[model samples]
Target: MTRKHIDCRSFPSEINCSIAISADTDRELLEAAVQHAVAVHGHHDTPELRNQLRGAIMDGPPTEEQPAR
Candidate 1:
């Protein structure tokens, strides 16, 4: 199965978070990304936010180096 990833640095945020999360499935990646967003980025948990996070997910292993954001 292909791994999925969500790179925080790829998104535009005030904090410019550099954290990246990866998982075996889109569901798992979304869950971890949501937790990181809430705990570290101070974003509130909401359906809309969840949808947005889901949309941001990418296909591949998490990269060690940050891509151009």
Candidate 2:
């Protein structure tokens, strides 16, 4: 099965976080993303937040980076 990943850089945030999380299953990815969001992003954990994180998950590897601005 293809792995899933979520890149903080792909999402627009006030902090412009660059963390990336990946896993073999959706559940694993969600768990890691939630932890990072709470610990690093100062986001409160909740059912709605989990759903949003799950929605943000992307299939396969992350996209290639463009040159820095």
Q: Estimated TM-score per prediction?
A: 0.85, 0.85
lDDT at 2, model 1? 90
Off by over 4 Å in 1: 64-69
Writing each residue's lDDT as its tens digit, candidate 1 over 41-62 gives 8999999999998888888887
RMSD of 1: 1.6
Model 2 segments more than 4 A misplaced: 66-69
Q: Which pairs, if any, clash in model 2? A: none
Model 2 lowest lDDT segment of ten: 60-69
- Summarize candidate 2's per-residue lDDT along 7-53 as a digit string, tens digits: 88866779988877889999999999999999988889999889988
